[model samples]
Structure formats: C-alpha cells, structure tokens
Target: MAAEGKINPMHQFTINQIGPKLEIAGYNISFTNSALWMVLALVVIWLFMLGGMKRELVPGRWQMAVEGVTGFIRNMIDTNIGPEGRRYTPYLFSLFTFILISNLLGMLPLAIVPGFHAFTTTSHFSITGLLALMSFAIVLVVGFWRHGFHFFALFLPKGTPAFMVPVIIPIEIISFLVRPFSLLLRLFVAMISGHILMEVFSSFIVNGLGSSSAIGFGVSLLSFVFIVGIGALEILVCALQAYVFALLTSLYLNDAINLH
Candidate 1:
C-alpha cells in the first residue's frame, strides 16, 4: 500500500520504457530505463579507461585513479588464480568497474532534480543473473576446453574415500550448480534491500514532516538521521558487493584452472 504524496520504495526498481515500445518477431525489444543505464555504465567505463591511456611519466589524478583500480584487480587475480590469471584481468576489471560504477550511480540523488531519477540495474535479478551466468559460462568453457571430460572430476575431491563417492559427488555437484544463483542473489538482494530501506525512511521523513504535531517533527528528525546513516552504509555496500562478486568470480575460475 502507498500513502498519498509519498513515493513507494519499490518504485525505484520499476522498469519503464524510454521511448515507443516495439515488437519484432514476437519479441518485445523496446528500449527501457534499465537498458539506458547499462549503456550509460558502459560509456562511463570506457571514459574511465581512457584515463590510463595517457601513459605519462607523472600521472595525473585521472590516470592514477585508473591505474589504482587496474592494479587492484590485477593483484586480486594474481593472488587468487596465479600467473595464468593475468589473462583474465581485462574481463574481471571491466566486471568490477561496471558493477561498482552502476551501484554508485544508483545512489546519486538525481530524484532531487525533477524528472530525473537514479536507477540501480543490479537490483534486478535479470541483470545480475546474466552477469553470473556469463562468468559461469566462462568457467565451463575453460574447464572443458582445457581438461575435456576431466572437468567432471571437479565434483570429487582428491582425498575422498571410495565408499563416500556417491554422497560427496552429489553434494559437490549441487554446490557447483548453485554458484550462479548465489552470485545473482547476493548482489540483487543487497542492492534492492539498501535502496528499499532508504526509500522507506525517505517516505517517513516526508510524511512526518507534513504533520503539525511535535511527535511528527521528532519522527521526521529521527528518520532523517537514519537516512543519513543508511546512505553512508549503502555507499560501502556498493563497493563491497562489487569486490565480493569479482573475488568470487576469480575464485571460481581458479577452481576451473587449477582443478583444486
């Protein structure tokens, strides 16, 4: 239920058509706010990467920032997946930066500017699920391409007793299958929950302030404090979730590469 003059928290997650809707071959491929944000994220990433292309002896702020993020991802890959991981640095770097930027952009107070609203794409499972599936697909392709049928051996550890093969293999297989869903839900739920908290508090502040009683003012003040605190925490969650996603992805790739 929604109160009058109060915006629904979940309204932020709604997908709206950006232009005229179009149907082709029984498929609806109309452009949407989500699609626009994804494209915008990619453009932002490209511009950010341009910062590193200058290759100067004394790096400027932009260059240093780009190098810092690149080095961070490189170090993470090296630590998790070893030298072979170097090859995957570009992909993982893009993945981390995209998610980080998108999450941060969603937190922008754009709604304050009439007709402009910040939308978080990661809050949707479809987007996160696609990212997870892409990573999982890479793992599968690499595992099979390098090891062929030996990839199935991932389900059985080296030290498992022969008698426990049935139980251990099934458990491991199930766990392996659940990886994508875990990745999807972790990001989707985290992003959505934080936004919802902020929105709910925002509504409280607005509704409370509109009332004339002292209790209303007190409630409004408290809600404002909560919003500020939650906003700060949400910023941290944005970066942390992106890092966790990249880290888990690299670890999963390590399993495929090392078979351990």
Candidate 2:
C-alpha cells in the first residue's frame, strides 16, 4: 500500500515529453526528457573539449581534466589492446565521458522545477544496448578484416582433439555470441538499479517529513542518511561501470584482432 500511494518511487523513471510531441507512422518521435539529457551530455563534452584545447603554458582546470581523462583512457587502450589500439581511442573516450556524465546528471535535483526535466540516459536499455551492439560490430569488422576466414577460427582454438571439436566449438561460439547481451545487461541494469534505489529513499524522505508522527521524523532522518551513503556508492558505481565497459570493449577488440 505504501508503495502504491502518491509517493510512488518508480515515477522517477517515467520519460515525459519536453516540448511539442511529434510522431511519424508507427513511431514515437517526440522530443523527450531522454533526448534532452543526451543533447546536454553531448554539449557538455563538446564544450569541455573546446575549453581543454586552450594553449597556455599552464593548463586551466578544464584542460587538465581533459588531459587526465584522455591519458587515463589512453593507458587503458594501450594496456588492453596494445599500441595498435591507439587508433580506436576516440570511440572509447567518448563512450566513457558520455556514460559518466549521463549517470552523474541523473542524480541532479533539477527536475523539481515544473517545466524543467532531467533523465538518466543510461538507465534505458535502448541507449546502452545500441552502444554494446556497435562495439560488437566493430569487433566483427576488425576480426574479419584482419584475419579473413581465419577469423572464424576463433570459434575453435588452435588445437583440439578432432572429436572434442564438436563440443568445444559450439561452447566458444555461444559465449562469443552472448558478449553484447552481457554488456548491455550489466550497464543498463546497474544504472537503473542505482537510480531506483535512490528514488525510493527520496520518496521515503518526502513521505516521512510530511507525516505528523515522531517516528516519521526519525524515519526521514534515517532516509536522508541512507541517501547520502547510497549517493557516495552510486558515484563510485558511475565511474566504475564506465571504466568496466570500456575495458571490456578493449578486450573484445583485442580478441577480434588476435582471436584470444
């Protein structure tokens, strides 16, 4: 009953239209909270990059931040995929920055205003799933381009008993096929789960503060503490999830190149 009342926690996940609603045949094309936040994330990245481009003897804060993030991803690609992976850094860099920003932006309190809105773009499976699929596609192209028919050899290791080939080959193929789904589920579920937990606590705080009982006041204080602790955890999760996705992507690319 508490969960079903005016304090419904899941309401936070609703994606509402921001402006004029529009749709084409069999498609919902309206500009929504999700679209708005994506553009915001893109603009933030673009502006930060531009600011970071300033040529001073001592780099400004933006420049330093940009350099640090660039160097971090640079090292990641180098270690996971080797020097050959240098060419692919831009894609991975953008993925990390976009995802990190989206997750952080989702935690902001700006949506309390009536007309304004905020959304967690990563919480939606569509965004993360599409990115995962693209990463997998890149792996396929790189694999086939480098090794041609030998790329299929990845499904069967270099040596195996001929009789065992029947069993091992299918197992390898299944695992390889499952990578994108695994990536999508990990990122999407993490984002949504954190957001849902935070929202539930937020609702508890609101409900408690509104109640007349002393117990409700104590509950509100407890809920506030939980929100703070969960928020710290969520910050770690936001960065960790982005890093893990990029690392997994680099490993996938390495497999494509070397068939590991």
Judged by TM-score, which candidate is best? 1
Clashing pairs in 1: none
TM-score, each model?
0.97, 0.93
Between which residue pairs do clashes occur in model 2? none
Local accuracy of candidate 1 as per-residue lDDT tens digits, 1-260:
25577678888899999889899998999999999998888989999887677999999999999999999999999999999999999889989999999999899999888767899999999999999999999999989988999999999999999999989999999999999999999999999999999999988888898897799999999999999999999999999999999999999999999896
Q: Candidate 2 on 22-133: residue-level lDDT in tens?
A: 8899788999878888999999889989999897799989889999999999999899889999999999999889999988888787757875545789998899999899
Instruction: Report the alpha-carbon TM-score of model 1 versus the true structure.
Output: 0.97
